[model samples]
Target: MLFNKEYYSKAFEYLLESTTYLIIGGILAVVFGLLILEYHTIWSDNWTVLITVIGWIALFKGILLLVFPKSFNRFKYLFKSKGFINFLTVFIILFGCLFIYFGFFSY
Candidate 1:
């Protein structure tokens, strides 16, 4: 669903609009990647491993985006459904908020 090329025309344009954005994104990628990579290494941890893989992917994407700023331009048309995209965006935000809440208060 998210892989649809129609949705990427200007996806990271805002975040990768300038050298400052690239630098910031790169820093975040390194931190997020290390933290995620450090947290899960065992294959037995399926879900965690999945997330770790995502982290690594994020790191790689971030690095690539920073190094070759024009590369991400290719992702501009992966998806085009603004309605579904907006829905998914909201879902993700809510899901993240729930996680934050659970992380702090689940115990």
Candidate 2:
């Protein structure tokens, strides 16, 4: 494939930013899962299944983010607006928190 410096640069920046959030989310999810496994007496039978699924899905997504580096390049334009970028960041964080919470507490 032909290289476009501009495109690749933008893509790299966005991918880096998004991947950071993804990593943070992954860590949070894992920690929450561990917490549930350690202290919670509820859902002992199925907790393993739910935690395994969530952990696997998050790990898969994190690997995909690192492997497919171009998926987020199109978001470059969206970052131009400060409000939009903040909104997107907050939305992503909220989504991650909710995902972790559900994975831990939903059973």
Candidate 3:
């Protein structure tokens, strides 16, 4: 979806228009984040540390979504920016690769 400009824009716009979707997504993010943290709170190893950080980020993003749904309108411009989308896509791919390496090869 990130690569597809039209679809991405449409989806983002749909999300912006639907406060109920955002609220549900926010709740889910918070629940999943808490679940992750519950088991990996120690952060003893690299994997644990990474998971913990992701959990915290999810929790923070969920809180932001729930508390400031209107504020997200300010970021709509970012979804339209091809450069930002490319950067975000690259970042996601790299992050996924890192997770894969840590999950399968680090040991």
Candidate 4:
């Protein structure tokens, strides 16, 4: 629900404005990647595989954001509309709720 046009614009501006985010995000991604890679086996289970892949993607995304900020322009082109963000926000919320339910209440 947070992925609004304003959030997108501001996130883009923030990435453009300073290197602090890049540095912090990169560090956090690296840490998470290492932790997940060490603690979770990529082939052990679906959840482990999912977390491992996400960790790797996070690491790669952080690197790309740090090294090639212009790469995000493609995403800007694709999601330039407010309508898309609204739609995506609802999708994400629903997907996240499903995960939450499965994590906490599913038998």
Which candidate achieves the best lDDT against the true structure?
3
Task: Say which candidate scores most in TM-score.
Answer: 3
Give the per-residue lDDT digits (tens) of candidate 4, residues 1-107.
37347767656656654667656766787777777777864676444366678777877876777677555555654465667767778888987887787678866
Tell me the tens digit of each residue's lDDT in model 1 across 32-72. 88777787555653334556667788778767766886665
> What is the per-residue lDDT of model 2 for residues 1-107, given as tens digits with 9 covering 90 to 100?
02344454455456556757656655665565555545543445543455555555555655555565456556666655555655656777887787787778777
lDDT of 3 by residue, 1-107 (tens): 55586787767877876889889888998998999888877667546588888899999989988998777778778877777767877898899999898889889
TM-score, structure 1 vs. true: 0.56
Ranking, lDDT, top scorer first? 3, 4, 1, 2
Clash count per candidate:
13, 0, 0, 0
Q: Give the alpha-carbon lDDT of every model.
A: 0.63, 0.57, 0.82, 0.68
What would the TM-scores of all predictions be? Answer: 0.56, 0.33, 0.88, 0.67
> Residue 87 of candidate 4: its Cα lDDT?
79
